[model samples]
Target: MTTYQETVAAEATIAEQAWAETFGRAMAAVAGCFARRETRATMAELVAGLLMEVDTRNCWTLGQALGHPGPHRLQHLLSRARFDHERAREEIARLVAGELAGQEVVLVADETGDAKSSTDCVGAGPQYSGALGGVGLCQVAVHLAAVTATMKVIVDRALYLPADWAADEERREVAGVPEEVVFATKPQQALSMVTGVLASGLDARWFAGDEVYCGRELRRGIRALGLGYTVGIAATYQVTDGAGHRWEARKLINKVRPEQWLRRRTGHGAKGTREYDWAWLEVRPDDTPGGNGNGNGNGNAAGAGAGAGTSVLVARRHRYTGEVSYFRCWAPGDVPLGTLVEVICRRWRIEETFQLAKGFTGLDQGQVTCWNSWMRWSLFSLIAAAVLALTAAAVHDGSERQPRLVPLTCPELIRLLRAIVLSPPARDRDHVLHWTAWRRHHQAVATACHQQRHRRHDQP
Candidate 1:
């Protein structure tokens, strides 16, 4: 007879097998990046080290993650390895598409900026960091990710080169910036990533981004490729009514009747469903359209008439505060309002993915100064994130019905990885337990204080 302990043991074995199979597939996807057998072996080691629990993700820390005393091999792999990171990126995209492909999957382009203190760090400059929510010294990268209902993973990334860095030959040489690297706007960078991913044969049903990537050239480019897109637009963006009347997005909000708003849940959150009221209205491009699409209405007067297709302006209102936001969507055929809303909701998945990658896999924790090294680190970190995401999907999904519980989250899976795979010694384990206990105690105290205040308010 199968006892409870035996059943648990069997389940553990199955889970481990699942992980091993997925990890093997991920490694194989990037195997062609390495030319020599030794480099291939080193690539495996680098990927495994990135998956392990470590204080940081650098050559030295990764050596520690692999239980090594030095970082020479890892350093060589990043700094002097002969493999092309771009080809590796293609493999990563292929792997992600295989794991989480759907006809309705969204291709998302967004910029992530990590604050940097050192001026010598590659691409570091005083720039506006969306991650930091303000202007600061940082390195910015444009990321292209594939997102669906079940998973989100970055498939391509490009570092943003500031105009000064691109113009200064001496600084470029010192930082090892490629000779071909030139200053391009964020939207232009996004289009290049989309073009590259398309060239690699990866497919997506829709393209999406924040307002930063919603330029005239980008919209036209996507249309030229026969792709649909839903991108955020500033409140000041102008569009024509179906009758060729021009109005800014903000102005159209007042034109929406109360009956047009639908209260819907945007997505699931840590607490519960994220509910908001949404409304949409049909709008068209101008009669003539050769402009930059920067919302300044300059360049080409053919703005709304670029494709002579249907476009929609969407408005979202916070249920509690009544705060409102807006988005513009351009899709082929008669796309349902619900479908467009779902596409807009999927935008938050990219933001959540960034949080998970940075928090668990150290997406922004590299200490490299060279351009190639930074790219290598990002590739490895993304690989680690992919493993975690795939493993979580396996553990939570599948037909094996052993026990039912809340689905595993990225943080929980990361903790399990640390406990089982990293296998900290007794002393380190004890320290972690102590830290957890302290945190629990602090939470208890805060909860008690909150309850006391509530009780007093009720009595009064």
Candidate 2:
């Protein structure tokens, strides 16, 4: 019922078609991401699957979009997606260093696991669960992208999760290692990608990530690389003060900045509504007495914690109205605290990518196999997503005294959706669905949702 409109806007040339062009450009840019060309399907078939329809055969096109090529495209573009994302990230880093983009933006890192049925996938196994429904053999990967000026998402890293099931030599053989790909910890796989992106000779002011990647080694790696970082760390994991007195990040926030703890700010209230106080200090992690997360060697937590490193830590005070809350940031001590804070906040932009890719661009709907086709399919969806956003941005060019950085509204979203669905040769139904009618449909949906909530006694 709900849809994206500006994504479907009209254009004279496919080249001039801003949304379509954006998708095309992204695909072209990521074209060489693969080392071998895959025959999954042609690029056209990939794009068509999303635009028109998808069947079993055409699904390979979507794989190409994702960075996989069937034996067909593998010869041309068949490598991991990390390389492409890294290249794009390097571009963003270059822009940042050249002062073309803001350094105060967030560099969010997150990993999403994909459930797969095939045990033969080069990298797939049952591991820690992240999805809501259940757990199965799945691949986990972390993506790093920069978010600034309320636009732009450059994914720099894509690390595949390698489960222990594939760790043993026999298991590796059965799972089929090509000899080039070695056994690596999930964190290591992710770190390699992160390091590569940074090694791309690009500079970023900060980095942020979820807990899976917030391990001590990862933090230490970032710090060693001289970068700032923020993460949604476990509340139970503690941080020690210069005096060697340790307290959980959550406990410290509660003890040091109680008022802001358990703050409940969401959506619109997130921006401008809350600001943070910044502080920097030395940090050392110790495993809690037992079974915490530090893996036993360290005394911070149980199974996982940053091992033996005195790193720079930042404490941020988040204030909601009159109450003040707290959070600590960890990074290479040399970097400024402000830079770390800026980068940590940028992680929010990735949420937009997920929304657009799945909800707006229709990337999540694919049910195909083979690495190549999957890659193409994903790429097409990604390109389409970027194009829609860019076109919507291009639509507004006014020099207002106070310009709205967030361009495009729900109306624009719907407009883009309608554009693709409504083609040439207007039908009788098209005449019935004029601007007025469209607006009414939009209002009706919103109103109906509200009424439904009211009926359920959960009206907002």
Candidate 3:
């Protein structure tokens, strides 16, 4: 007779095996990116360390956790390893597309920043980072994420280089920035990544972003690709009505009749359903064939043109605070207010992706200072994150049988992997002594360099 405990144990074993198999396949997909067998092995181990519960997933700590004698091997993997990280990123996108085969998908554009104390790091400078809550010294990277009903994964990323950094040859050489890499605005980076992803055969119905992406060029580019968009806009942005009257977004919302505002639920939150009052007004498309006479950039002359999609300015008012937000929306034909609200809600999925990637896969934990090292570390971290996300989605799909159990989350899945699949951390005396010696040796070198600088200053 099969007892309850025996049944539970068998299920647990099956789950562990499934997760291990999925992880292996993900690593195998990127194996061709590395030419050397040695570097390939190091890359696998580095990804494993990122998945583990290391305090900080930088080279030093990750090397120690992986039972290496020192951090040199991992450091080489990040800096000078002969591997194609860009190709690996494309492989990741392919893997995700396969995993989300039948679900409806959308492309989401967003950016995240990692705070840096010093300016030596590549692309680090004073910038407006939501991660830091304001303008601060950080390295910001624009990312494009693919979102489905139950899954979200980052498909592409580009580091934002400030204007000053691009013009400074000395800093560029020191940081190993390529000559072709120049200053690109966040919106431009988003457009480039989106275009590349679409060209790579990833099908997406719509594109979504924040205000940074609501520019004339970006919107035009999105339309050219034949994808609908729902992007945020500032309150001060101007629009034109069918009667050739121009009105600011904030002022235009007041004209909406009291009964016209409908209460709609965006999605579920921790508390409950997130409901808000919504209203939309049809506006003019800015991507007309020729220039409009308004000179305000709104295509008022293209009103009711053949094959032109419906353009509208949508507004959402909070249920409690009454604070309103705005969005510029477009679809092939007229879409319901509910559809626009849903797209607006989906834009927030990228924020959740950033949080999960940083918390579970050490997305922002790299300590690299050069362009190549930073790119390699970020790509590997994202690969690790993608694997976790795919595994969790698979687990959640089979969770309906147990009504009492909550859906499997990335953090919880990681905890289970650490317990069952991953090897226990090495705590032997020899392992501890090895890492201790390595740290002290590096400390000595850094101290000597500082002392030499001080002596040179005194001599002058």
Residue 213 displacement (Å), model 3: 1.1
List all candidate RMSDs to the true structure.
11.7, 13.1, 2.8
Clashing pairs in 1: 285-304, 286-304, 288-301, 288-302, 289-302, 289-303, 290-300, 291-300
lDDT of 2 by residue, 1-460 (tens): 1122222222222223544544455555545643434422344334433543222223333343333323234323323323353344344344333332333445566666667677555456776555524567765545556566545454443436364544556645654444566666656665675676565544565667766666767665665666656765665766765455776665554444444223322225444554555544455443222224333233432111334322444445445344322334654324444455556556666866765566545554554333443444455565555545455444443212123234454234435444553222222444434534645776799999989888889644
Segments of candidate 3 deviating more than 4 angstroms: 1-15, 288-307
Q: What stretches of model 1 exceed 4 Å from their correct place?
A: 1-12, 286-309, 399-404, 421-460
lDDT, candidates in the order shown? 0.76, 0.49, 0.83
Find the candidate with the highest TM-score and give its number.
3
Q: Estimate candidate 1's RMSD in Å.
A: 11.7
Q: In terms of lDDT, which candidate is strongest?
A: 3
Off by over 4 Å in 2: 1-17, 20-41, 44-105, 152-154, 157-159, 168-177, 254-327, 331-342, 360-406, 409-460
10 residues in a row with least lDDT, candidate 3:
298-307
Please count the clashing residue pairs in each candidate, in the order shown. Answer: 8, 78, 0
Against the true structure, what is each candidate's TM-score?
0.84, 0.60, 0.93
lDDT of 3 at 231: 93
lDDT of 3 by residue, 228-280 (tens): 89999999999887666789999988899999999998888899888999998
